[model samples]
Target: MLIDLSSNENPYAPSCKVAEAAIQGLEGMNRYVEPEELHMLRKALGEYCGVGTERILPGPGTGYLLERVLCGLAVGRELVVLNPAFLSCLDLAARLCKRIVRLQLKPPSFEVDWTLPASGPALVILESPNNPTGQCLISREALKSLLKNEDCLVLIDEAGYEYAGKTFMDLIPDHPNLALCRTLDKAFGLAGLRVSWLVCGDAFMKALHMENVCLCRPALRAALAALEEQRAVLEEVKGVIEERERLKAALSQLGLEVFPSEANYLLVRSPRPDLGLLLRKRGILIADLSGQWFSGYFRISIGRPEEHQALATAVEDILRTEEGFMD
Candidate 1:
């Protein structure tokens, strides 16, 4: 099916209530949007986040939220991030009125360095359960240490938190300098809607020009529906998580070095690069992480049960037949 694990998303749709609510919301299509729906979304989201609704800032997605965050912050200097980072961080930082520092992650762990710029204001960002290789976390102690050394803003992207089983949202209300951002696309299955939000301190939120509903009428409806019945959405998420664990084990059994992941993807290293290319010829698509290092590696997404089975069977067959990480 040409599964697109390249982007972290649940193939499932939002709750059944989401379809119903979307249909119901369409009935009021001719009229201007009531700020009330957005207010309701923020309320439900706040409850979900375990924070005040006023603390949550909703947007199109992480892209929009990050853009606004960089634009809104007048932190007199630049942005420093872990290189091989989610590319957008560097892309957005480029447009900002600041210097950009790209630090490569320390090998094996891929953790960022704590020695940040000690000058004026800085925006230091990191991702937990980060993209591409899906390298899980940087430890709570590391997070605390990073925050302690830099007086600047620390943004943590929690896009994959649902699969990772952790979040800093609960910490945002208490930690004035921390901002925790999340997107509905991964867990909620609302990728088409591009709905996302972040919980920051009241001071950080109040400074920006806030709007009740920033997305279009269609996306707002989807966001509300998804939030209203998050339990069902989470059920699908659990399935993805379970499948990921199974896939990880299968890869390990084959003697391939599979980088441990808390998210719904696996980074498997082969003795040679040809197996990755071979999988692509067989119509299987996964990222080639080989170029990043001198060694051979590829990342595969954990799809639905059948999709995962196909991947497992393919790997097993490859080993049983044309083994040797063939070209």
Candidate 2:
């Protein structure tokens, strides 16, 4: 079997309730999803997020909701994003915003300055535990202070929130300009369901014209079930966390520059840039990030212990066989 560690998908299967609910949802496939059913989802999402139903808006996924928010609300505003942010975020900003300001992340540390220069209405997207790099943009306290400025709208993409355990959701109560986007696709192992929610404050929610957009019946049911059994989801996350530590230690022992990550994946800089191709030849797939900001670096999602061990062995073999391969 091929070991695929490119995408940061949960290495474990979903909760049992998700499958049962999905099966139940299939029986109602003949009808279009009802509005009341979606409202129910909103309620569940609100309860889970510790926000009100009005503050929560569910859509196909975070990408869809993000596009909608930018298209509808960010027309006249400028877009400020960190370098090496999500590709989708970049595409949306370019298509929708009039002006784009990219803040270059500091090298080695790969951290961005949270403070913004004097600017007009702008939509700032912050990806915590950023993809590929796996570094968080800012801390909770810095996020709160950034929200207080009221000069721009802050969209915090907390897709990796479960791994980092740092959030600015509580600051939403006081900051009307702040909106947080979360998804079940990451930690909850529900990527195929396309279930995500955008949480906004009262004033921000009032400004936008959110529709009755909802996920499919099966996805909604499964999302609700997943939320109900969230404890089990956390348990699975705990296993991933443990595996991540083990994998990091193992990779570091191999003398590779493994970057610090608070997410499900690790960013590793190999002495051999051809390591990705070598691993792929052995039926192991990883994220080759050479074209991206991290040259000579690849991203590997923390998989099961066996998968990690296999990767370690493959790396060792490739380095041993190849000439001039530095540690």
Q: How does each model score on lDDT?
A: 0.72, 0.82
Cα lDDT tens digits for candidate 1, 127-186: 778765676556676666766643577788888888888876655765667788888877
The per-prediction CA RMSD against the true structure, in angstroms, equals: 2.8, 2.0
Off by over 4 Å in 1: 27-32, 133-136, 290-295, 317-327
- Write down the lDDT that model 2 would get: 0.82
Give TM-scores for every candidate, taking all chains together and pairing residue i with residue i: 0.87, 0.93
lDDT of 2 by residue, 1-327 (tens): 899999888877686778889878888698999888889999998898888888888988888888878876777788887765564656777777878887876557886677775377777877777776777768777877777767678888888989888777888888898898899999998888889999986556876665557679999999889998888788788888888988999998887888888899998988888889999999999988777465678899988899999999999888778765454
Model 1 steric clash pairs: none
